[model samples]
Target: MKSFWCEQAWLPDGIASRVLVRADRGTITSVSTVDTIPLGCERLYGVVLPGFANAHSHAFHRALRGRTHSDGGTFWTWRDRMYAVAERLTPESYLHLARAVYAEMAIAGVTAVGEFHYLHNGGNEMGEALRQAAVDAGIRLTLLDACYLAGGIGQPVTGVQERFSDGTGERWAARVAELREDGNTRVGAAIHSVRAVPRETLSLVAGAFPDRPLHVHLSEQPAENEACLAAYGLTPTELLHEAGALTARTTAVHATHLSTKDIGLLGSAGTGACFCPTTEADLADGIGPARELRDAGSPLSLGSDQHAVIDPLLEARGLEHGERLRTGERGRFTPADLVAALTNHAAVGWPEAGRIEVGAPADLVAIGLDSVRTTGCAADQVVLAATASDVAVVVSGGKVVARNGVHETLGDVGKLLKAVV
Candidate 1:
């Protein structure tokens, strides 16, 4: 059992002062107001929000961060470089790299991450490495094992693409069934994209893991939509809808390039949209219709895809910034809405998390208001004013995993990343 006293906490009702939270075995037991701090209770100053959930991530891409920005190149060119790195990663090497990457996320206030893993190398070794990595980092993980069976529409697997394919959807499902989940991990399903998975196999992958969360790489580029439309005579969104892949349990990773009808199809089906604002911008992927998707019944979530940046606070801020730039209006999404998206654990199969109420996971992120970036900001509006540097203390599953931008158990995250990358 453990107790924490927050100077100010973002409770479900509203921000409360002098709040006390109790936890036992990593689940929040009780929450109430307190006049004074009790002995042995950890004191957390500033505003304490629920730990951020990175709804979309590619753990191995952390290595491609600053290395791909030298020459101006298109997303296709970036893929060649990414594939080069993917081909060289062994299970042992990936375990070390992913551990540092996840530890980096921990210090940035992410308590759970949804890893869109496709670098299987035709087995579950890489998947097992990711599971162990998350356990060592003291954060929850949802491995969205992807099904990749083609190089492109009507194209055969070639070069490094051969490493990603499992011959057929049946083979993909059989291998995925071998991946067992533990207390710190959940196994989920992903369709690599309309380009990788053919029309015939889409439905099989969609229904393969009916009880778990489903994620997919939506139209992040205009070329992808062009190819999908030319090949199937339908938009990628339409293709997914035809396959019965759009559902409340499904999340579209980068709904960037979409037709009006495409948006309608996704929105009407109660699917979720996960916008990676940093990665979208970094990779030259256009800003997605975030506001429209939200109003269309699709819940919104945020992620630091590709690890161009791993700060959920920045992603939350970028989400609003992108909307404002697209619509020529400010406050497209209120701070509360941004916070909701930042801590949307349900998008990653952890529906019981991302809230401060009892019965949720005991995940808390204390953001210091005194930081230079957030000196005069209101507690509720800190999502716009602060960055990951303001995260003073992080508690995941009732344990202090990071303090003041440094991982508790791993010490200097920079050193860890340096040793691996």
Candidate 2:
């Protein structure tokens, strides 16, 4: 058993002061208000919020952070450069790189990550490397094994994209079935995009993991929409819907370019929309209809896709900021709404995580109230003002894995990232 006394904590109802949280094993057992500190209990100062869940990520993309910015290009052009990096990643090299990347996310207050993985390299070796990396970094992972059978609509796999293909959806499923999940890991499925997977195989990938989380790259680029429309005489969303891919357990990543009917189909199907605001802006992908998606019934989640940035707080902020820039309005999403999106563990298949209540995973992230970026901000509104630098302590599964941008076992994140990338 363990206990922690927080200066303030973000409870389900709202923020509370002098909060006491108790954990047994790796689950939070109780939460309450205590006037006095208890002996032997750890003290977490500042404002403790539920650990963040990164709903979409490509762990290997961390290597391309500063490399791609020197050139001007669209998402497709940036993707070509990304393929170069993907081509160089052996299982051994990827293990080292992914460990460092996951460690960076750990210090940034992400307790869980949904890796939108597609770099198969012929087998599950790369996926196994990722699972080990998450364990070493002290975080939970959902390896969303992707089915990438095509390079584009009506195109064959070429270049490094061949590494991501498993020949057929059945082969992809057979390989993924070998990936066993334990306490810290889960297995999920992903459609690389409407471009990467043919329409015939869409149902195979979506239905492959009927009981697990399914994520797909929706219309991230205008070109993708045009290509899908031209190829199928239907939008990508319509195709997915016709194939029975849209469902409650599905999440559409970067639904940036969507029709009114597309949004309605996704929301009415109870699907989730994961917005990668930083990546969208970095790749010049347009702002998505985040507010409209939520208003139409789809739950919203946030992701630091491509690792262009790794801060969940900043992702939440970017989500709202993108809304403001697009809608010309303030307070598009309330503070609570942003917090919910940041901590949406269910979107990644960990339904019992991302909250500080009993039965939830013992994940707590303390953000410094006195930091230069967060000073004078309201406790509830800190999601709007803070960054990863303000994270003082990150506790995942009842263990303190990181503090002050330093990992517990890995030491400084800079050195970890330097050693690999």
- Cα RMSD for candidates in order: 0.6, 0.7
List candidate 1 stretches off by more than 4 Å.
none
Tens digit of per-residue lDDT, candidate 2, span 296-388: 999999999999989999899999999999999999999999999999999999999988999999999999989888889998899989999
Give per-residue CA lDDT, model 1, range 60-129, as digits (tens). 8999989998998999999999999999999999999999999999999999999999999989999999
lDDT at position 207, candidate 1: 100
Top candidate on lDDT is 1
- Tell me the lDDT of model 2 at 96: 96
lDDT of 2 at 264: 98
TM-scores, all candidates, are: 0.99, 0.99
Instruction: Give the alpha-carbon lDDT of every model.
Output: 0.95, 0.94
- Clashing pairs for model 1 are none
Worst 10 residues of 1 by lDDT: 258-267
